[model samples]
Target chain A: MRLSYPANVKIILVPCTGKVDVMHLLQAIQRGADGVYCVGCLEGTCHYNQGNLRCRERVERVREILQEIGLEPDRVRMYNLSSGEAPTFVAYAREMTELIRRLGPNPLKHSKPSIRLEEAA
Target chain B: MIVAKRKPFEEILQMIAGHRKVLIAGCGTCVAVCLAGGEKEVAVLAAEIDMARRLKNQPIELGQTTLERQCDREYLAQLDDRAASYEAIVSLACGVGIQFLAERFPTIPVYPGVDTCGLAVNQDVGWYEERCRSCGRCVLDRTGGICPVTLCAKGLYNGPCGGTNRGFCEIDPEQPCAWYAIYERLKGQGRLERIRAITPVQEWRDTVPRTLLQPGYRKPEKAKS
Candidate 1:
């Protein structure tokens, strides 16, 4: 089944979302990605039993880290859908793109006026 | 193994606030296993620090390295050539490793990235419960292999107190009463009589620096001058 999602959403495929590490999410934002979202298998239906569940925890951790560092936690998210749910997958992709659009660009992307950390503090 | 947790990023960011170049250090042994200051953690932290500093418009240059064990002089020597060059070093090891790193490179300011908690048992992924307190004495023989000092909220030596409600400690309803668990364990082992014997009060004195002299090691006397 052919379906289309936002062209702006660059996909990075993993064998299973469980392989997505916390650093992967953080690095994406650090390198100027406006947002990052992990789409794992439906909660209990993960083929690997707990792969998707593990991914969910890592996603939540990254979200908390983002929030703690003074950034919007909403920039990162976790969505679960089954293999048969192509329409749901497209919907999630579009929804993620829309959310990121509203959040504007990542704060790290554009440089602000030069100021010492002491002054910035 | 030693357990530790990363410090709040805001506090870590402030630790090297004035520094333009920094080295983020990590330990591979206990911290790595505990998911604190391992190689992956160093990379994640370096990325975070880089992004945080850049957002503030005072971007910092971050470098990182993870040693096998930061507590040992042999492993700390791996950073010998590079440790002295950084403006500040952020160590993600436990307190012992941090002190060792600081001692090795006295001129550079060493800041801790993680708080060392205690010896723990990994109950599950990302879940660690304290198992030992390093009280310098072992009394597991009397307590049926359970440490009363660590498991008992009151650190009582005799047995469970009035606060041992059912099988849980009163301090935290979720925590199991140490004495109750000990009793159950002894009963299972057919050594229930162990609980009846009075365990003498422990001596908590520390007259000399608590240093261990393992076999085949240099003595602490420094060759008697």
Candidate 2:
């Protein structure tokens, strides 16, 4: 299983993708992550039953929240893959990296000047 | 529980627009259970609003607090002095809590952050279905614990209306007709005869803004004897 994906793509493993709360994705974005994506077991094939399904719902909800706040909803996503599908995982990583590259850095990271001025005022 | 939903983000922003500082008051009881105005939701909303405002160059001074039960005067009193610092308060409580806050804080303008839906039962995670309308009359005994007032689209007491087709509601094909459910439940309990007993016209007087003085509390004038 020696697969080469984007070196810049960092991964944070979770017990189950269902354990991925909305706050986790949001905090990642707030902490200057250009993009965040959850890779869970394939739909209906979750080890803890509907863990992947629940993660999908949470991703959609976070997407909606992002859209409401004028952020690029595409910056976050949920992907399904089984343990054997290493190729698919690499493909998803590449796809997400490309999407984020096109979208540029998260606006929050660049908007510090106005925020600093606001605090100073 | 009294279910509620957050008002649209845009609408909420509009409410506190001109104000530079505001407090988000969350209710920890019913609205929390409904996932609308709990402590976690308050934090999420605060972060969202803060981010949105910062993006627009109109950063707001936002504070957050959650009351054990917003409807109770004692719980609301906790914010007595602290709430004075903010220009306005955005209450993430049900309608009752919003009104209660206004009453308790006569000088402060308290805005509603959530819309009180109705009495609801959790259908599943993130899904709630209205179960009762609090119509002031209990008909669960006759309806076999199925509430037609809230479940039926038309709120018909003597029902299984003409719109019912093969036990499904005409309004939504996916939903079972409330009266059909009532009939099945009664049949299962061997209480089908209860449905036949003509229910009198519901007293509309009780439906108005009514208050019940708890028996142990101050007795009403009529009950003074």
Candidate 3:
């Protein structure tokens, strides 16, 4: 019998988390991400005084843009994890994987059904 | 500085739907100082548009350029060599600059990316509020520096509205009641008594029908022998 491994998800890593620009976040959603989140240092402990805070603002703006485009804002998220928190990383992946399982494919994919105005209305 | 904000991404996408080549023009003037339509914004907008086009499988070429001053002929002339190459030009300048580009490049269509918000004062980073309407009148001497016509929300020239609560405007809780600010300024300068007299209704006709004039020029006359 052949052994099989569970499907894995990809998480983009950034420096200080604040470096993640709003355009990058919007592009990720536009390019079709199952679930996206920014993992940074704890609120006050950010290497940069407020890099995490900046990332939080960008995430909020991205959420607004998603809502404007009729997409679910909940699909995007933000979180923080310290370097030693390997378990926390695993938990995040698990949580995202489960959410992805329920969410299915990304709405931005051309293969998926397009958003209809009348139906949405 | 002339503060402005870009239209929504979808709105911009719709504006240049069928155009293949887009020239993103940025003005290094009031728009730049306000962090609105500067060079950085031009590049970001171009990238976003390009990404949107590629995502939809409709690839388009976007050329980005910034002018020292879009309203001046010297800055606009810098694009003479390459201006005709693009199908459309997206101007990230004030309304005046956008029209200037259109006049200089009559063959190409120019689309305004930013909505001319209003004359504003930057409170701080990422915070700006409209401060003046520039109704072509100057009455600040009597009313103190605070502009009652613009900042008051209701444009009341006399004093705070009845709805004012604890120095904030009723219209927007975040905004300071313009008339109240004016009153305080007058009190500080001992000009409170001077402003007690009501100001008359301003001639609003000057604010209507926008007009543009070329600098240092006069209409040519049709001469006869």
Candidate 4:
């Protein structure tokens, strides 16, 4: 059987994970993802010399924000994996799926009003 | 250019603690140039607040949006409708943007996420220093065009006072005395004689309680209708 991940976990494929801006990372959280992770080229191996570095910085910054917002910073994570790193990719997927599973369903799922209420309180 | 720095995220969070619905507004101008308040900043703030609320199970409705220029009413008009939805607004723009947001969203409380420091020019990437004070009355035509309001430390309009030492300022050893530089610059230009003319004290109103005006940006009567 082909290995698949949790149906609820949405994987976004970016050309280079380094291209992810801090806002985009935050936007993922705002859009109601249970957990978000990025897979990018290893340090110093990015297609763009420092794109991965920049993306890593963004991820780290988001982690700090998550903590301030009273969430576990672990909710958003970044990993360095070249295109050929299939095992690493699958491992990351599994890890994120497990984390999301523990986090349970997204608070905003199918309930905009309730999400807003929850957010307001 | 205005120089500013991001207030610590925690400080910002504390400022908007009571508001259930919040908007993070970024200025696309001066603060953006410094990488403090811009679209990226607004997004980061919104996300941080969201995550914080989620973790606490307190949940705060947060929105992210940016304006091209916070000082211009034309650009600020964009926030009109959305401003009503949020209980409070956090501005990442310079002091101007924060004030503009307040003016536009009078009913909704507006907060600043960055401290608007004095006017400055980038000394290098990620570095900036005080430059202009926009003192309304400009005297750059004389004194070799250097601004005294920001540079002189004393805002002196005359020759270097007794405090200057070896052409450096007493206030800061790294800074060359403003009048000393002005003297040298004007002497080289053969305009040193102009220093004898005392400039009237710069009016205080021009430099503070800052105001912004955008010509011809008001919606026409037809548009308003």
For model 4, the superposed segments whose C-alpha errors exceed 4 Å read A1-18, A24-60, A63-67, A70-121, B123-125, B203-225
Residue B47 CA error for candidate 3 (Å)?
2.9
lDDT by residue (A1-120, candidate 3, tens digit) is: 232322576656677798998768766666666668788888898878999999999889777766655566767778788877777867776776777678776656653222111110
TM-score of the candidate numbered 4?
0.69
How well does candidate 2 reproduce the true complex, by DockQ? 0.22
Candidate with more favorable, higher DockQ: 1 or 2:
1
How well does candidate 3 score on lDDT at residue A74? 69
- Ranking of predictions according to TM-score: 1, 2, 3, 4
> What overall lDDT goes with each candidate model?
0.86, 0.86, 0.77, 0.76
Q: Weakest 10 consecutive residues, lDDT, candidate 4 chain B?
A: B216-225
Reference contacts preserved by each model? 0.31, 0.17, 0.02, 0.35
State the lDDT of candidate 2 residue by residue for B5-118, as single tens digits.
999999999999998888888889999998999988987788787778877878788888889998887788788767788888899999999998988887889999999999
Interface RMSD for each predicted structure: 10.2, 7.7, 14.9, 8.1
In candidate 3, what are the lDDT values of residues B175-201, reduced to their tens digit? 898777887888999888967787888
In terms of lDDT, the poorest run of 10 residues in model 2 chain B is: B216-225
Q: TM-score of each candidate?
A: 0.89, 0.85, 0.75, 0.69
lDDT string for model 4 (A1-121, tens) is: 3556557556677777767887777767667767788778889787778888888888998888776665667878888877777777777888888887887765644333212211110
Residue ranges of candidate 2 with Cα displaced over 4 Å: A1-10, A82-94, A110-121, B160-163, B219-225
Which lDDT tens digits does candidate 1 get at residues A5-97? 899998899999989999899878887789999999888888889999889888898888887766899999999998889999999999998
- The candidate, 1 or 4, that scores higher on DockQ is 1
